[model samples]
Target: MRTRFTWGLTVNIMPPDYELRLKIVKNKIAGHEVSKLIAPEVLEYIANNCENDVRHLEGAINRLYAVTAMYSPKEINLEFAKDALKDYIGSSVYITNNIQKIQKAVAEYYDLTVESLKSKKRTAIINHARQVAIYLCKMTTEETLDKIGLEFNRDHATVIHACDKIGESLKKDEELREEINKIKDKIMN
Candidate 1:
């Protein structure tokens, strides 16, 4: 008896265009082919072990666009369509760095370190600075609760609580918001 292979069985094959697009993205990002940057075995491993879903491929492409936007050459006006994929997934690093920078500026302005701000030992000045730092970090960082916890040496739950408290305060505290804006401007400049 002869067995027939279903159409579904043949659909796993990737088109040449998809492979070429992957190569172009890889080269643009890394100045090399994906195969050159990652080992052939590793590539094969990902191809074999991972889901062959179009969504997954699309996600990867989006991530590339995000990285490009974050680190794009200053002179280039990153074409919108070319970068739409990246914008969709969004970015954590960009948010994290902006937060970190703002935190650093606020700390410097108040003459404190981020560690000191996060610490439980708080005078009035320390408490205020800490609150500001928490607010800015929340506003600026795409850091998840777990990542923010690691940054402040707190548990994720604590980070969430801090964010909630600070967010509430920011809504009512116009003076504090103004100060934070000034500091952000300085740091961004």
Candidate 2:
């Protein structure tokens, strides 16, 4: 069976053997394991690179254990790990899809009949629609500022500024907030 693990911004699958390796790696990194010196950098490197299959992650952990000379590591309890992994993957997918839906809905709401929201345009209504799309994308997506900028053909800083400007206005401008809320409700439902 497979499980999931999250280390801040990154989420990945963790196999049953992960806990066993984690304990050994933790001890080794703390310099408590005699006759073995597993560097902390090794675990960090693996975590950074291993973000796919749990079996592959287990292999990486196994290699770490072998290098550290930690023989006969305990078996990991798979139940909790499996649940955590599922939650992480599900939540990540949910967030990503919802953001995409929000972007689509914003485009449709503005009635801009463009084939792609990312297409180039400079008219006032198109610009307003683009700003609203950017605002919704910012509010919903986990995409980086640079990625959002590229999506809208603007600088990352411009995306940030748009998000901030809209966010501030939404807080104090009741009519604008209401309009946004109505749009969001329409999209969500």
Candidate 3:
């Protein structure tokens, strides 16, 4: 003789919708105190690309944070996200070119753009960062100065100068040596 506890209206619990998934990821980021670390663009990327399991969002954000920490990139963007979360995103070579990877590491280290590094910007900061990137590309890869220069929108002369300048500077400038090492670290790992 069961009493009046019958089910009135059955309510089916479904997987979270898109907005909720986004909110869940965001809340997880906040909970991890890494809201400031993650880029807004990556939030949407996570929402769009992550599997149906919403818990994966938090794990993704955490993993992203850890990976970026090693590289110490300034701004985490879509390309970086795609590369860092390749396990989740699949084995696509978003950053296939070795030159591109060097440029990305150098740019992120200096908080500059690859385009700006390639441009004719002669400001002190941009110039130094460009030289550093050029040096790294030359040192790390077998690509000729002509090829590296083409990537940076310059000729072999510019690549040669950058290599000489940064190379000379590294001899005396301990800070520059450290910076270069950091950029290289990002590039390698």
Prediction-by-prediction clash tally: 1, 1, 0
Least accurate stretch of 10 residues (summed lDDT) in model 2?
Answer: 75-84
Best by TM-score: 3
What's model 2's lDDT at 29?
A: 40
lDDT of 2: 0.51
Better of 1 and 3 by lDDT: 3
TM-score of 2: 0.45
Instruction: Tell me each candidate's TM-score.
Output: 0.46, 0.45, 0.49
Cα deviation of 34, candidate 2, in Å: 40
Encode model 2's per-residue lDDT on 13-128: one tens digit a residue: 55423233434445444543421333333342233233344544555555444533434333322222222233243343223434457667777777765345666767776766
RMSD of each: 17.8, 16.0, 16.4
**Candidate 1 residue runs with Cα over 4 Å from true position:** 1-99
Stretches > 4 Å off in candidate 3 = 1-97
lDDT of 3 by residue, 137-163 (tens): 765554667899999998989887887
